[model samples]
Target chain A: MVALSPDLTGLRTPALRRFLTPGLVALLVLASLWSLSSGAAGLGPGQLLAALTGDGLSARDEVVLYQIRLPRLAMGIAVGAALAVSGALLQGLFRNPLADPGIVGVGAGAGLGAVLAIVLGGLLPAGVLAVTGSHLVPLAAAFGGWVTTLLLYRIATAGGQTRVTTLLLAGIALAALAGAATGVLVYLADDRQLRDLTFWGMGSLAGATWGKLAAALPLIALVLLMMPFLARALNTLALGEAQAAHMGIDVQRMKRRAILSAAAATGAAVAVSGGIGFVGIVVPHLLRQADGPDHRRLLPRAALLGAALLVLADLLSRSIVAPAELPIGIITALLGAPVFLWILLSQPSAARG
Target chain B: MLQIDDLKVTLGGRDILHGISLQVRPGEVVAICGPNGAGKSTLLRAALGEVPAQGRVTLNGQDLRQGKPQALARLRAVLPQDTQAAFPFTVAEIVAMGQDAGDFAPEPGLVRRALAEVGLDHLADASIQTLSGGERQRAHLARALAQVWQPVGPQGARWLFLDEPVASLDLGHQLFVMRLMRRYADAGGGVVAVMHDLNLTAMFADRIAFVIGGRIAACGPPDAVLDPGLLERAYGCRIAMNTAPASGPWFVPQAAQAG
Candidate 1:
């Protein structure tokens, strides 16, 4: 619905956008290195460098370097990047700065799905449990996310139009529904199952292993690679659905793809890392403030920033309480809550509009 | 050419558009004028397929339903009544959305030309959220212009459907946009405009179609259709027809005279 003007001919260069993305990527790389080196095991840059260079190390140090810390770092990066990019997608798709996996119920849905698998695993037939062993939680979690997202999308959309107000309302309803279901699952669980549920709800990278990483990496990578394709559609969507259709975007198709991808990425992240909070909402909003609202730049920058922020948070979580590790979700919420308030306070009028 | 025949639209189980028929030819500006709630905007939207309707619409002899949205977009463009942007996209990025629907990237020069046509060239990098309502309306017009910037089909003519485009504009901008529509028509394009201002419609429209009670009550040249009795009957108020030396035909309400 853009109008023509007599003097609207100049092309915008967006100079800062060029530098901001690469800078974030570089920062993420440095953060990754720092995370790889620092830990409770007293590993330093020397050990990290030696490990990377394939230099020989003492057996115990080698186990700590290769097994304990490396997979955790990889899991942190994957989960962080996935959550952030998923947040960016949902925000763009919903046209709201506050939209995130957790707020929209995808996280709670995944959590419920994983909880079900944990508490109800013994009831399934031997064959189904055997084949789905170790994989059951993630698969169930992904299915949970998919169903909830599909329901949310359906509820928010009608007659080929998606309203942000309706979406947020539906998200709230769905999140509450998922939370209640998870609570019911918790009540049914025994002591061991209860401990697992509690730990998973708090979120951590401490349980990360190469096997979990391998299980989640493929889904996360698929969503990440799909971002480039989704970026253009999401950008056009900012103009509203009717105008997007007028410009030749298949608005329905774009909505379907974006919702599914966000659900998948969020599901995988929650499946492996429990309930890490704020990465999705925080990173994307900050990047948009710095880089403008072009999804081409926003999505990738969100991915990198999400990766870096999670890695840095993981480092803090491990070191903050020393031998007794703090939940990563706790750190993210503390960090994110302030930023969320700042965003809300800064644009008091935007929410009203 | 754009054609609609016997179109009927029902929304929420209420009939919005009764059986209606009309045709728009190239190199002409056709204004669909009516009183408020006369289904003026609904008529335009139904033809654009934004809402489901029972009708037959054809563009250049091709049924609209048979064509893909992308293909139809290349042949015709629409400027809706509301142009509110949700995100704080830069003006350039917002305008660039017109090109994103097609298979290939639009040349940056075309986008600039569209913006320049709407008189918003200097604000290309500015955020759309910062623009005033009138400026945003112009920006949206520029986007619509950028969509079918060139007439590429076999007919070598494009169609523009605008719904009360100048409803939010000042007097100067109202004429500016009306003149732009006139220019687009002069360049062998067709424009279907939903207008509330009768004087402006008489000045720019090659033909006028008066919608009353969800139907085309009158359709013809400005002089022929700007009849006092027909307008009075349509508006449920007294109307007077007048001729201006410079503006051709105009309408004046006779409510004061009756009182």
Candidate 2:
């Protein structure tokens, strides 16, 4: 006996959608403003506003605002968005909530690639180095992430199904492999290069310069732009691959595009910011709990929420110890790990999925 | 008409379907039946163009492979055997996925209409992962039905290709699903299903196909294909084909020692 199930068109969270995006936007705005105002220099809101407008702003303040903070802020926004979106995309592709770039070895692969380019760029011919120039490291990192993703995908999937246990185990192996390779590069590097690598490895936004941000932004922006188009396909993918295909998705092509975009995003972010963990894993989970996992909403909202979270984390990294500065990675992990534990503990089945 | 010309499929260097060919016309329900490993599902997939095969499959004279997925989906909807939603998605959300798929203009209230058709209207707000197996099966059927809500679309005749659509349902629900397929066929759409229940297939199908060991052993009207000797050989057991009072031929497998 069928009950008269009426109008399900009401499913779209109308009240939630209306408020969530703007709420995230406002949060990002507040975080950015708060971050810009409080720092080692400690510019108050009015002074920061004055400095921003270039009204009665001193040359020292000008350099601090324009040369120092702006680039870091921009880099934080870009890297944060890229990491979170990459996590969302990877999770969708793998069809598991826990498929993060950092956990799955893709971020380590990207880091290895960046280190390789730095250490091995010296070995390349003068002409080749000239052609690659500033772009070499980030490009190599993206390629490395792409290759690692392909390898993991190949190992974990058979007969159009992915075994989660295999994926996690292979990720552990691949992460070790990448770490070993990175260690070898560190051993080969000279003192100056070694110092750079050490600081970079800790994952700081302090190295955020206009030139470096420029190098990473194009790739990050490209993938962010690609996410909206992927939303429908990713939603369909939540229902297994064959079922997604039956729903008229070009499943194989969608898989390739998702991997490629995720790789590019993660590689670009890691190359510039150095192994920032948990924003990718944390931001999406928070949003999913906030509403639900509809990628159309999730992807864009992820961009805003991720940017806000990272900017706040960056603020804490710089401020918590006052001027000496902690690595942004530390702040993210410290904040992210406990939340992640809560998620794992609360819904063991959803986590397993 | 949906036509299959000598369809053959091989997977992992082994043959799964061997030169199978069949024709299905609009306005009729056809069932593909066989024991386990008989390639019944494979044949259905081949016709749906879900698997690679070395033959021609044409629906309404258009090569199934030539059409883009969007184009093909506009003409037919398939309900796969089992699909897991990786995320927690509500029933209404799942049904709406099909109702407005690929940006097609949905018929007014078709998603609710579909949920009602399957008696899932009461649980429209419930998550799909929370439903029972039969409930999930009917939910998917509703999604498939919503996708091609109109039996006749601008593409002429839309179709429903169901793989064990009622395999998880109770007897009453099984009969309900079969009747739903029959009604779709009668309304000028085609229905091709891989079925497990021979009695239900006999009752609902205009034509029945018996696949045995990657080949079609018999395919004809229910009475013709429901032969005792053929069923026994195809299924490797004793089968009793009995004539009910006023219905088509139906059969039940006899015990190994009973003869």
Model 1 lDDT at residue B183? 92
**For residues A1-353, could you state the per-residue lDDT of candidate 1 as single tens digits?**
13211112223245665677778889888999998888778889998788778898889888997898889888999999999998998888876777788877888888888889889978999999888777777777877887888898779767545565676688889989998998898999999999888767768998989988887777788888889988987887776777677777778788888887888788889989997888988998778777677888888888889999999999999889888888898999998988766654544253433
Q: What DockQ do the predictions score, one after another?
A: 0.52, 0.48
On TM-score, the leading prediction is 2
i-RMS values of the candidates, in order?
4.1, 4.0
Tens digits of per-residue lDDT, candidate 2, B117-207, equal 8989998877776688899999989988888888987778888899999999999999889989999999999999999999999999999
Q: Give the distance in Å from residue B160's predicted Cα in candidate 1 to where it truly belongs.
A: 1.4
Q: If you score just chain A, what TM-score does every candidate get?
A: 0.88, 0.92
Candidate 1 residue-pair clash tally: 28
- Model 1 chain A: weakest 10-residue lDDT segment is A1-10
The complex in candidate 2 yields a DockQ of 0.48
Per-model TM values vs. the true structure: 0.93, 0.93
